[model samples]
Target: MCHMTACSLLSYIAIAWLKMVPMQTIRSRVQFMKISTLSLIFCASVVSGNVSLKYLPVSFNQAIGATTPFFTAVFAYLMTQKREAWLTYVTLIPVVTGVVIASGGEPSFHLFGFIMCVAATAARALKSVLQGILLSSEGEKLNSMNLLLYMAPIAVVFLLPATLIMEENVVGITMALAREDTRIVWLLLFNSSLAYFVNLTNFLVTKHTSALTLQVLGNAKGAVAVVISILIFRNPVSVTGMLGYSLTVIGVILYSEAKKRSR
Candidate 1:
């Protein structure tokens, strides 16, 4: 959770400095405040979901991620007073099915594990739904850069205190910053710059795309992250996991196609 907060802070700094997005508004102060407040809740949920990963298996975490679209549908429906048809509500079937099929398989399933993963999913799904609301409600007022400006840094506030309270070797992180390790620094750099850029891109996508499309794509991001984890972290993958991933992608496509019909 702390780390996610820090990441949000880092993202904020990156967003503020890079300014060329074109979301002009008369209510700059109001919008800023609104954005900041929303982001705080947003960060809490995002951080909570992410931190849950520490206690749960990564694959399990990924499975939790697959629920995001369902949450988004509910949130969007409630906020917009846009009741989905029976088919729209039913779209969840493929989304969840694909996720289950794709989750690579976790060996050590337990009550605690189930609880942790469910909690994580709930957190992330809520966050995703709120973000979609934010996008739908205020996207034109916030291009990618402005969105970053408002959110990335605001997110870090959640992390700083957590770092001080929860973890040891805060000094090490500082010392790590001081060192000339291009490797480690690049990781931070990548997270701050590239990650934030991707976040902004996602905002743009969510704005132009349906909430369901955004979520479907977002799930794909999780799968891609898993692939990256395998490559960079050398995490082992199972055939079931691969199969599950395939199903998830297929399910996402079905959901997207179904969603497209409504639009």
Candidate 2:
């Protein structure tokens, strides 16, 4: 996480130095507040999602995450009072129901993990909703890259203190481990660079489309990941699970067509 933040901070500096995005783009306090809030939500969601993996099967985690569209729609309506087409809401039912069906046999579920996963999913939805609303205003609009630059530093500020408090001998352990596995440093660097792109693309999508749309897209991505895992890892997938995933894909397609026709 530290590596991720450091990479973003360094990238932000480089971009600013190159005058690719003006430094003044993030000067407003209102903009800072919005970015900072998003940073906190993003950081917390990531941490909780990671921690949940210890107690819940990956299937369960994915299932819960598949509910993001539901929360996104709810929050979007609550915050903006913007009602989507009735078919849009109807489509989310199968999207969510299929995921639950896919993970119905998960045996490693725990209460804490379930709570954390739900929290993480809800936080992700809330972050998307808030980002869409906050950035939509003419006065608050910022280039997605510029917003990421500002958000990364604030997230670092919020996460650093928590890391210091929670992780014992973090620096000492990291140094000792790195000495035993020299590849650790390179792996961390690669992970950090990847993390930057994830954040950058997330912001870009939200900037270009509604948060609810992003959530729907995320479900499709999850389905693709499941297929890739099954193919590459030769993992066993139950017929029920396959059926559920098929339903989800079908729902996504129907939803997209519904949206297009509405437009």
Give per-residue lDDT, candidate 2, residue 169. 85
Looking at candidate 2, the ten consecutive residues that score lowest on lDDT are 100-109
CA lDDT, every prediction?
0.61, 0.74
- Listed per model in order, the count of residue pairs whose N, CA or C atoms clash below 3 Å is 7, 0
Extract clashing residue pairs from model 1. 9-156, 12-152, 12-153, 101-244, 102-244, 102-245, 104-241
Candidate 2 lDDT over residue span 1-263, tens digit each:
66557657766765777665565466577677878889899888888888887877565566677777678889999999978799888988887777666665444547898889988999988997887776687877866676677777878888888888899889899899899998988888788877776655665686789655765677677777766756765655677777776766666666666666677
Off by over 4 Å in 2: 18-22, 201-217, 229-237
- TM-score of structure candidate 1: 0.71
TM-score for each of the candidates = 0.71, 0.84
Error of 1 at 57 (Å): 4.2
lDDT against true structure, model 2:
0.74
